[model samples]
Target: MQKPEPMKDQVPWATIGLVLLWYGTNIGVLLLNKYLLSNYGFKYPVFLTMCHMTACSLLSYAAIAFMKVVPMQSIKSKRQFLKISALSAVFCFSVVLGNVSLRFLPVSFNQAIGATTPFFTAVFAYLMSNKREAWLTYATLVPVVAGVIIASRSEPSFHLFGFIMCVSATAARAFKSVLQGILLSSEGEKLNSMNLLMYMAPIAVVILLPATLLMEENVIGNTIALARNDIKIVWYLLFNSSLAYFVNLTNFLVTKRTSALTLQVLGNAKGAVAVVVSILIFKNPVSIIGMIGYLFTVMGVVLYSEAKKRYG
Candidate 1:
């Protein structure tokens, strides 16, 4: 008898464990960063991002050299370096803008706004690929974008700068996903996720250092205050950095092992989880319309993913 074909979306228990790890660590980093920047009063998103990049760079190197967690892949030429540099810049912008928005908005509001990422992703995917999606797919994003607009207008803690940065970050994230996939698939220049991270993290360091210096002031003074207030902030920041690494790692692992839609579904679920946990932890005031809009946005993500699964 012939063996049955393997299911593309079948997820083993091990993969589920990684998904849970991804969820926990993601929430941990968001909450920890918010605490440090807001209540803990660190107030340096660029500097904080620079630190995470530095940590990930050093740790990525160590993993390759010492632990052999990922085999090393040399950047073969300047063209490859330039490609990696561009990817790194887009990645940096997405993350740093996210970190910056925390200073001006509550975590719940930030995440509700963030749930509209699929809208941006859909828009960029069409523009770059020039592939027209099914009108049903396009219709799915309408509510997602509308919901975010409603939430933004209704959020009690909304700041114009934060709102703008968050929206831009969402678009950058969407663009990066599309561009990174294209860049990695280039002829004779494929890199696995870990190798990509290894190369990209250093470029991020170079890019972020100048931005941090230009955008933030009195880092040394703030560091002293943060440390003196609670040395535990330092410890949590280290943990946050480490989680950032694992988040990237598990993301790659999840994609390689499961169906494409699995990750996107989990991504939508993560946005919902982040919004709920943010509300509980931060106790931020959200208007009724904002809650309604948040739910609409999340539902739109689910419907959009399902629509793609069926038709796209």
Candidate 2:
């Protein structure tokens, strides 16, 4: 008898475990990030982002070169490395801006803003790939945009700085997705997430360190000394980096076992879960209109994902 296909015929227990791992880690990272950024008064987003990129680069190198968790696939030439560098530029901004946003906004509100990423994804895909969506798909963006507008208006603790940074981060993330598809459509250029992480994370470090130096007042050395003195800060920072790696790893695992659309759907669901958990943990004062608006945006994303599955 022929072996069953792994993607189509997943072992039920294994799939369930992976789903739980992905969900738990994704939520855990967000909360921890919020705590470190705002609640704990460790307000150095650029440096924190630098740390994450540094850890990601080191961990990814080990996975590709030493652990052999994924077969190593290095970029072939200068042109290819340049493309990866461009991708890294956007990714670095996305993460740093995202961390910056968490410093001012409640996590619930932040995730509500993030739920609009599919709207930006639709826009970026058209510009980058010249790939147009169906009229219905275009129409679906109305609710996503409108919901966010309403949610932002009613968010109890709205901060203009956080709002702007969150929106920028969402747009940057969408751009990264579209650009990666356009840049790596070739079979030879394709790298699994770990290998991609190995290359992109280091490039991001190169792009971010200068920005951290220019924008952040605290030197990297000073920050490290401070974190070392605080035992809890040290562990949280380390755990955060480890959690970041698991995030990328599980994203690859889920997409391989299931489909990209399934992962997208799960991402939407995760955003919703994160929002609810944030409200509970932070006791954020969300109004009824704000709640309704968030629900609308999330539902719109679900619809958008389904439409993409069919028409995209």
Candidate 3:
């Protein structure tokens, strides 16, 4: 008897575990950063981005060095290198914008807006894929938009600028996800996660460093000083980067195993978890109506994911 062919979309339990870890740990990192930034008067998002990217780069390079996957000189194709570099810029930009938004918006507010990433991803995929959504998906789109509106209104007093910034950041993040999907599909022919990560890491650091220096100014030096004075910052930086990278890997693996829509919707638990943590810890002011709005947002995400699975 011939052996059955392996399923391409069937990820192992171990892989699933990684994806969940990615989602939960990502939420944890956000909570920790919010706490630290709030309690210690630290400029977090920017500082953390620089530290995390630098550390991830170093660790990723060390792994490549140990495994002998690609020597320093093996990136011979200028086109591929440029493409990864561009992707790195986009990813880093989104992260920076997100961190900036966190400075003004509560953690839950940022998470709620960020949850709309799937909607934007769906829109971009539909546009880029040239595929028409079914009537059900179109119907579900209404509730999803409505849910976001509801959640956005829950804030104490919305700053037009901050709201716009948060929405822009969310859209940038969505764009990054779509672009990553495209780039991964293309360069995946030649690059593994570690290689892509190793290559992109330096590019991100190079691009982000000058931007941080110009915009954040003295905040950068102060953060570095804090990092040295408190060894805990070092641990936080390591855990933040390593866990985030690992989680993203799991997200990628799970997408191969399951439907993107399923992952998007189910992964929304991150927003809910973040919202609760923010409120309990930071006391983010949320009215009853706003809480109701969050519930609707969660429900909409679930419904949207289910619809996509059926029709997609």
Candidate 4:
């Protein structure tokens, strides 16, 4: 009998489809967020973020409980609930600041600043866990930081406060990722991303409610007024909030289907695609230096991913 031939790996169409869906939801939510905050005069980032959390809370519950998409995990202890609350608080901060930055900065420029997340992630990992990356991995971040500085100077519509908000938001996001690992490192405490969101969203909504009411001036009344003038604003909020949940869902799905490193690589490309698409949609002006800087930052991110893959 002839020896059987070894089978070659086939294309993963299901994973590819999920990736495309991930890209669509991620970029769609981002563009819509920019539109609502800047062009549509929402003017209430905190409240908008609250709405997103509320939607996530409802949608995630339905997905887990009714749809039976994933096994629901319960909080085993008060300590775990507290950890989830802390993560939720951090999440609220990152999201609201991101929306506020979008109100002042062009989407393209905002994405450029957000690309520096890897630099912040590395810093937080070291500070929080005393963990260190290889020297080459650290070296990869230099261009990431430098590219943002170059882009900041060259950006046609640079806003100082916006830049600060964007950077702070990025840092907060990275901090949350690191803190999540530290807080939920144990096998018993570890929750899948979906269950984590399911538990965290309601806590985030609770946290945001008082902050939104206190920080924003007459946000509810103004939103009602806006909706009265154009009922489409109601529809827009519904759609935008729904997209926000989908963004989280798709992100979890993509990471489940592919490795985390693949997700990071896809994320770098997603940011670049978002930048190009936003510039075209919003007709934002970009200088050659700005484009070069954005590209340079993206290249650094790619190198950082590769370095992590190899060094780890």
Pick by TM-score: which candidate is best? 4
What is the C-alpha lDDT profile of model 2 across 195-290, one tens digit per residue? 888899988888888888998876667667876788788888899988888888888888888888889888888898999898899887999999
lDDT of 1 at 198: 90
Q: Count the backbone clashes (under 3 Å) in each candidate.
A: 0, 0, 1, 0
- lDDT string for model 4 (28-96, tens) is 999999999999888899999999999999999999999988898999999999999999999999999
Q: What ranges in model 2 sit over 4 Å off?
A: 1-11, 221-225
lDDT of 2 at 225: 81
Worst 10 residues of 4 by lDDT: 36-45
Per-residue lDDT over 29-86 for candidate 1, one digit per residue giving the tens place of the 0 to 100 score: 8898888888777788988888889888988888877888767888988988898999
lDDT of 2: 0.88
Cα lDDT computed for each candidate against the true fold: 0.85, 0.88, 0.72, 0.94
lDDT of 3 by residue, 1-312 (tens): 999998798657776676677677777767766656555566656666776688668777875688564454356577768878888888787777776676677887777677676678778877876657787876766666677688777678455665777788878777776776776565334565567777888888898788777777787577679878987876776777776565555565666667666567657876787788778988877777767776776777787778878887
TM per candidate comes to 0.90, 0.93, 0.80, 0.96
Report the Cα lDDT for residue 279, model 3: 84
* Candidate 3: count of backbone clashes, pairs at least 3 residues apart or interchain: 1
Please estimate how well model 4 matches the true structure, expressed as its whole-model Cα lDDT. 0.94
